[model samples]
Target chain A: MSTLISLIVSGCATGAIYALVAIGFTLLWQTSQTINFAQGEFVMLPAFFMLAGMNMGMPFWLAILVGTAISVAILGAAFKRALVDPMLRHGALPLAIATMALSIMMKEGVKEFYGAEAQPFPSLIPAIDLHFLGATISTQSLGLLAVGVAAVLALQYLLNSTSVGRQMQATAQNPNVARILGIPVERMVMYSFIINAILVSVASVLVTPLYLAKFSSGETLGLAAFIAAIVGGFNQVRGAILGGILLGITDNLAATYISTQYRSAVPLALLIAVILFRPQGLLGTAEERTV
Target chain B: MSITRKVSRLAVLTLAAGFMAAPVLAQPIHLEDVAELSGGGATVGTNFKNGADLAIAEINAKGGILGHKIEITHADSQSNPGVARALVQKALDNNPYVLLGPGYSGSVKVTESLAAKAGIANIMGGEAAELTQTGNEYVFRTSFGQQSTMPKVARYIAEEIKAKTVAVVWVNNDFGKGGRDVINAEFAKRGIKVVADLSTEAGQVDFAADVLKVKNAAPDAVFVYLNEDESARALKELKRQGVTVPLIGETTLTGQKVIDLAGGAAEGALAHVGLTTDAPIPAVQEFRKNFAAKYNYVPDHNGIKGYLAIYVIKAVTEKMGKVDPANFAKTLHGMTIRAKDEPGILMDVTYDEHGDIDRQGFLVEVKDGKQVVKTILPKMVP
Candidate 1:
């Protein structure tokens, strides 16, 4: 039981991180009708930026803010504006390919500058383990969980209460109708990119202490979160969160109980099952199309 | 007029033939080195290049190999197996007398056969167990084989540390898994209980769950076989979980990058250091000083192995008086050289039947941010 409890605590901590990444995928899909395949790179790049900023003698928290702001304001917004938005007009396929290219370019470019070794990120929180309910949890894990949950709640509040959120939702539902209603659909899409970048930055910064920042760090993460987005509900923000958490928990449980050698297979199996049985995902409604 | 013209034409033809023959007779010994300088394996590749460059410089200064100046042509594998293969093809086309690196196991494995077929002596630093099993005479290693390093590590864990039980955690890859198997076999021989056996995928960052599992097992000590990044992350996680079990790391932990990445968490971490930077031995101290003076940085195990590769090649080739690939293989296989016989950071360097080294590695402990050699193990038998 103690072992099970440990697994759950760690699993949930990782799940929270996955949830944030999934939210990045879901937010972009909802507003822009295109998935940013480079969502993971956005998460990885900011950690590198944060490290660089800290190395430059900036305060830790201030470095994080500056790094995250660059990822959102400059990297994310400029990328979407210059490349993604233009390609998106042609179709989702073009946009996706472009995002993948961006992902590769971003990873290789960082690798070229930083070298291929994993650079250690300074721990934002002190290394303290708290034992509760027969489980030992690190302070970093607890902090990540708290931050992730808060971000999710804040996102919910934004979507449910804010005028911009409603406008974003209107544009997502029908761009033509939303444009007729003077929603500025293009701006909503741009905002979606910026918002996703912020979420990605937060997720990456939180996890870097655990993983260490590296060129390949974003590859597995991006793929896993993309799968979570599909499994939860491709177009639903809340579903993506749930999907990410579920995948994380399942992966940890499988590693603990089944076999670490086969743990990767578990999430992939879940993805296949979800695609076959519920193509629209567990929480997603099937799209109604008129022939 | 016709006889005189014929004699002039014969003279011209003789001069042209002599000119062509002169270049071939004076052709210098060409060595090819390809390593992952641009991609994932760049850390090891960079060190390998530095060490190789230093060794080549020293050898040339003393007097070129057999009075023929040795020249090295290098290529970047980009840490990709496909790129490694292409580079091997390129090197073979150049028809170098010898080849030096291409570090990662996968890259070495992909190109080993090509080197064997081409009959080029390709000295590599990859430690995967299967690398020497292919019966490729052209393939030689300057580093420990996976099988060679683990037995000493297991002995250190069991006899020296006096750990009754050990938990094994290794990366789920050819190199890591091979080391794990050797550790298990060695532990079983010593009657130490193999309490927990765990594996993690390559490039894993989060070790909370994995470390917790090992903690739950309650082993006296933990043996880890992983790459630089994973080793650092695992060490940090172990510290975070308050698992104070003595963590015995493989040679990968001996690298400077691992210590730097793990920081204070790596204190008291014991590892089988291939070449200790702080060895009191004059040769090791000299190597450390020379490398630092040249590169403006401390040399790691990877760098030392690169230096050893060139040193060994030079030692064997000088005795031959002529650089020939087939004769070089025979010479490397037949000879057993002591630490005094050849100038290297290792003790006794000998190639076994499988082309693996028989040198015994030193056990080192991390003390005050330095790798301090504790003791050298017994000479390993072939």
Candidate 2:
């Protein structure tokens, strides 16, 4: 049915966004054994910066590029140095609480500066509607899908082919061993944070037009993406992508068939089911701890 | 001369000086604005303050009420109910003649009781129907309540649009749920069947499923009880799903944010509004011009109500000559100022016994990228 197809298309779009967030979670957790709870804010704040750049008379593309670059290079590095690296030594709970505090600060900071008006981001792609397989797709949705898949492919290529990517992987697998092998483990962890920032920023740029760049945009987006990461397999890259897509589709299908009143509960239900049935997730490897 | 004679002379000189400097000694009439300045509701709170500020500035420029300068002090509520109560207490400590706003209905409901207990009149645009019905004599709403606005929407849908079956999708919140209850009750009275009633959580972004549900029901029209953000997203989803049926939303849909966020999809979407700025009324025209000049942006319904709240207070107090809290409340209740009589208000404002405004609700549709008046319903005074 057209309804089913429509739900699938929208589900895919939403899923792609969640996948980016899940990847951010997986990247940092793998490299540094830390979770950035402010991952959603990472997506949200950059869209505002991009808009700020555009408002300052920069062309749209240039602003987006510069905004994304700055977010990745400067803000990401500063966040790791100030919050993550400093508090990470205190333990996971402290770093998580710090990230939560960071999220609140980012939200309030943007709100104070930009005001609470839900400013719409201009569509990166044309608004032309393309219909295929009984579903209508906007060019913007297509852009999101393209970017999501391309980022995933590029990340996979880097992890497998490049020397630096292998070094980073080796550091994530066993930091002590990688350090003994002369690989810079700390630098890899920092690189992971930078990459995390870039992934979420890309998601923000692609999705901000559909949902305007506003203060509270991060709350639901971050929560849902965090849920997706947990449900998919927090440690596996492909699992995070699969988790995002599945959560998105499940949300839409449940909303369509069951009830909108209970749609919000579906993601949590999925999380619970995954936790009960398979503690390590569908694609996650169970870690063997040596005492 | 004796010491008593000198003291008497000093007392007489002081008394004479006090009498001579009476104009300078008189206290300025102060109104306190308790607003959500730094939180979720700050967008409207700040705009509402700006509107009130404009009115205050104009009033002062014309020598103020009863030759007394009007001063307004703003206390940020932070959009929390507890904070709103604390701000009202702080405002009361300063002994303001009137308490202005706390943006949303929840905060208004919370602080109105405190305002009443302190004998300070509260003027706000919080449209919750029960705000006045709680026997809080100090609370007066400048905006139309759901009881007044929703019934007219029902009548418009049934009588004018001739929609037999209506589908309802509302955000799951106080405002949206409150709107839903009223719309259902009003529709039941008019004998229109509500086919599907769906509600999504407050911050929900994806409406594809909700829209598809409406599409399946195939109602003659869809009525959305949602805020500006949710309304924009839902309307867009409705369009993409190719459901061409008429989409009517609550008054919040008339906001410019809906138009800006929804873009082309917002076209032809009808909404209930208190008054149209383009209604060929000089007062509205003047307000539009002055607001744009002052704030560098067009004023919405919230801003207009905020602007009018101050003027209503001024008009009432000016007639009474002195600012007495008890007298002010009584005077406002007894007053019946229509659009034709008042230069500030665009709609007829007659406060009922509960202090809810008895006014006509205007129906507007987005036409050619702007809100164009579709029709005006006759006033149904409650």
First chain TM-score in every candidate? 0.95, 0.95
Question: Candidate 1 — which residues are off by over 4 angstroms?
Answer: A288-291, B1-29, B36-42, B54-87, B289-299, B336-348, B378-382
Best by DockQ: 2
- Cα error, residue A111 of model 2, in Å, equals 1.2
Q: Estimate each model's TM-score.
A: 0.89, 0.92
Q: After superposition, how far is residue A265 of candidate 1 from its true place, in Å?
A: 0.5
| lDDT of candidate 2 over B273-315, digit per residue (tens) | 8855655567788888998899877767777777888888887
Give model 1's docking category. Answer: acceptable
What TM value does model 1 have? 0.89
Report fnat, model 2: 0.76
Residue B39 of model 1 has an lDDT of 54
Task: Please list the C-alpha lDDT of all candidates, in the order they appear.
Answer: 0.81, 0.81
Q: For residues B109-150, write the lDDT of model 1, one tens digit per residue.
A: 889999888888889988888899888887888878877777
